[model samples]
Target chain A: MQVRFWGTRGSLPVAPKAGTIADKVADALVAANGRSFADKAAALAFVEDDLDFATGRSYGGATSCVEVDMGEGPFIVCDLGSGVRELGLDTLRRCAQEGRPKEWHIFLSHLHWDHIMGFPFFVPAFMDGAKIIIHAGHPDAEQALRRQQEEISFPVPFDWLKADIEFRTLETGREYEIGEVTVSVILQHHSHDSYGYRFRDRDGKVAIYSTDSEHKIDQMHDENDFAQFFGHADLVVCDTMYSLADSVSMKEDWGHSSNIVAVDLCHEAKARRLALFHHEPTYSDADIQRMHEETIRYEELTRDTDALEVLCAYDGLCVEL
Target chain B: MASTLEWQVDKRDGGTVVAASGRVDESTATEFAEVLGEHAETAGARLVVDLGGIEYMSSRGLRALTLAHRRGEEAGTKIALARPNETMREILSISRYDMVFPVADTIEEALAS
Candidate 1:
């Protein structure tokens, strides 16, 4: 399975400067070459040229859409935030290029606007013969989607979409199968109810996405909920929207977890890899790098085991398992 | 196991104040109902429930509170819920119990009401 991050910033979108990607790639190459003076100078020149090429706004086309390909006919997607627009376009392009119909199973975490705002803009829903199955935890989730398409808010009515779409409400503690993968849903604590999902492939390779959850101070250190939800998963993509300082102070009861809390949960669950997600919109790229460093330092200080690998998520990063 | 219900009563602001704590489940609902009946008989005054310490509640708990509310009504005494956390508040909102019993943001407001 391959997991790709189309958008990682939470609450809003952050556009990367044009040469930033080139600079990062060049820096990686230079570091691999043992940081010779010639390599460093060439990397610096490459970064400067890339920055000039990026002057006309070359980043952040969409919001928080992530695409997961589990080697199945139907692709699995999580959330429909503004990032879904880009995902939809990519899917359409893939279909056009491959001459195959696009099938998508969308798993929604909740009905919050930030989580659902990209649904209407998804182009495939307007395409003929497209199929979409939406799995949500809330009983009224279908109605909520329809409400967004009402004439009051949107120009097009819900029926105007040409795709064959079905909504299925999932009950907690029940496992649902899609081809070779099984998904289990766990009710998470949020201002409005939300769900965390665990996906396991036939080979027992597991990936759990448990975002938009606010953990109690005690739960952050305890392994109970983590073990039950994500125990020994190969990859855990978790919400790390706030710092511990913000979460304990002003953002208490705000339904989001801190990076430290997410790291602690990942460590307790014995997850092999942790991809810190839901980056606060205000966090710059440099800010995220600093957070990643701090998280590594904290993980080293708290956990003696070397099983944990923490990485900050960027908009277009991908991981295969 | 059958439900067990207990109520510790105190006198406050010329009214009968009850501090109800612990899980109000099926086994305790009947006992809770009996205690409310007895309290209404003795106090013959307004009632304020301090439910700050209740850790959990089910439909049976709601039923017990409703029965107590009816008893207060028959005895011409008012009953109000004082200082509920967000979880209890959600239960009250979802069950529409906030309309059945007066809700106070603070204990003083509950006692005064």
Candidate 2:
């Protein structure tokens, strides 16, 4: 299974200000130190190897959206956040190249604006032959999507879209089979609540997408259930939108989780790898990088068995298992 | 097969002190929380939880502390955490529980706080 992160930010999409770009450029030039590259490859190598990730690249500002490919026919995507625009374009290119019908299985975590804002701009929805089966945990999913595209809010109405779209409300107690994958959903704590999905492929690789969820300390039963839901998974993409202090204090009950909670749950589940996801929109790349480093250290300090690999998910990051 | 958490509750200087040791993880956190909660029941109770002997503490443990502190607040109880060892201190620090809860290096300091 190959998991791709098309957008990883939470709440809203953001782009770095011009000044931030200028600083990166200035820092790169200073590190270059008057050395002229003979060719583009050497300069590319310098940027890739010499410069740190925050200095050379960004964590990206797209909201939500991730794609999981199991060498299947229909594309399986999670969320329709603003990042879905880019994913939609890529899908169109792939469909044109492969001569395949445009079909997608989109699983929504919730009906929050950031999670659905990309739907109006999604190119596939505008295509006549496209087929989209949107599976959501909430029964009001269609209503929410349609409301977002009302004339007062958006120029194009939901009925104007050309795609053959359908909505399926999945309940938490049962597992559903979609092609070669088995999926299970769990209700989470949030305003209006959200759901977490666990996907198990034919080869027994498990990938869990759990965002916009909170693990309350007093709720041992809920945390245990989450651990079981994440049990022995190959990859767990989780919400790490705030520091532990913030998540439990000022932002308590805000429905987002902290890196410390992410690692602890992953550890409890014995999952192989954890993808720190749902980047806090206000944080710069350096802040996210620092959180990633601290999370890795925290895991090391707490591990009693095999180490759980921790990686921060950035836009365009692809992980294969 | 015995429980992984060991704790002692003592009445000291117009307050209650609960010294907890061992692993306060998923398996033991509830008991740890219960221990702290029981002692902090009285109104205006001065409670100090000594974590110096804890070998390991998870986020659940921190949550347990947070919940206990909140309970104490409602009861008008003054609560402080004392003497977290290196492992416990780092966990507390990382979770920013140190900021929410008053933490001390020694039981004597915790008692005064």
DockQ of each: 0.02, 0.66
The 10-residue segment with the lowest total lDDT in model 1 chain A: A52-61
- lDDT for each residue of candidate 2 in A40-143, tens digit (9 for 90 to 100): 99998999999988998999999999998886578899999999999999988888898656898999999999999999999999989899999999999999
Error of 1 at A45 (Å): 10
Which whole-number lDDT from 0 to 100 does residue A212 have in model 2?
98
Q: What level of docking quality does candidate 2 show?
A: medium
TM-score per candidate, chains pooled: 0.65, 0.95
Q: After best superposition, candidate 1 residue A76: deviation in angstroms?
A: 0.4
The interface root mean square deviation of candidate 2 comes to 1.4
Clashes, model 1: 6
Please list the residue runs of candidate 1 whose C-alpha ends up more than 4 Å from where it truly belongs after superposition: A16-62, A99-101, A218-223, B1-113
Tell me the chain A TM-score of model 2. 0.98
Using lDDT, give the best candidate's number: 2
Q: lDDT per residue, candidate 2, B1-113, as tens digits? A: 55667778778876788888888877888888887777777624679888877887888777777777788888888889898888778877777778888899888888888
